[model samples]
Target: MLKVQEIRELIKLVDQSNLDEFVYEFDDCKIKMKKHKTETVAVSVPQISTQAVDLAPQATAVEAAAVKQEVEEVKEAPAPEVKESSTTENLHKITSPMVGTFYEASSPDAEPYVKVGSKVSTDSIVCIVEAMKLFNEIEAEVKGEIVEILVKNGQLVEYGQPLFLVKPE
Candidate 1:
């Protein structure tokens, strides 16, 4: 039987890679993960676990959160010929410090704190994340331009999930 933590690690690997499907058999249990181009990671445990039968569904929920990030990256560069060389290496990702609902503005009618092409300093408030009825302001720890918004307004975000990609100054 595989531990729950081990299963989560596998899910992360498959999400980061381009593989469409991943299968692993441990003991009498078989865990499979399938990725659809337009959807989140799907996990299926066809075989029963000798240790715990109830753990299957929990693993599915974990994999479901793999990403809304699969929504194609929004690139700022219009130059189609720009090579991949050292482009992403210089970028900094502003990730969610906690799991919550991501909001672009304090109020729904207010303007967003930042947007693509907007410049930011380390102390700049970029967005707000609401968790357990508390609203937390997220900052741009790195000085840079907002190159991409990874999650949509009102979207649910997980801890350590990339919220924005910044081209550092």
Candidate 2:
């Protein structure tokens, strides 16, 4: 049986990610979590054995009620639409090579490798992306002047996600 804390942490991770659903199965246990609308999470545990597991007893009644209430409240709320900025239409994008945490500088105290209006060549290191405790130097493959930084420092970035907008030299 999965612990309540573990389930909560998994829900939090799914909430922060771009995934719509998460599923885990082991032996006779299967747990599925789905994101409904915005800011709402719905958990579903299917019966895998003759003796079904009781997850309610694992968590306090109050905590379970609160989570249910929050889910209901979010369900009643409307989802927001996302639109791209018109200013970035003509700019060339520098995308992330892998999914990881983005960092503007080598270290917290160091200056950013590149900024808006900074000139860059194909070989220039623009930022670092840390994945599995390893920091990788991301290069600006296109020679250009950086016009915009799309991602903030220390933000979670996905593979092929646009990190910067450059004006080709």
Winner by lDDT: 2
Per-model lDDT: 0.68, 0.70
Q: Please provide TM-scores, in order, for all candidate models, with all chains considered together.
A: 0.52, 0.57
| Model 2 TM-score on a 0 to 1 scale | 0.57
Candidate 2 overall lDDT versus native: 0.70
lDDT of 2 by residue, 4-102 (tens): 434444554565577777777755555566665533365332211111134344556676566555544433533222226887787788988876789
Model 1 spans with C-alpha error above 4 angstroms = 1-86
How close to the true structure is residue 24 of candidate 1, measured as C-alpha lDDT?
A: 78
lDDT of 1 at 97: 91
RMSD of each: 11.0, 8.5
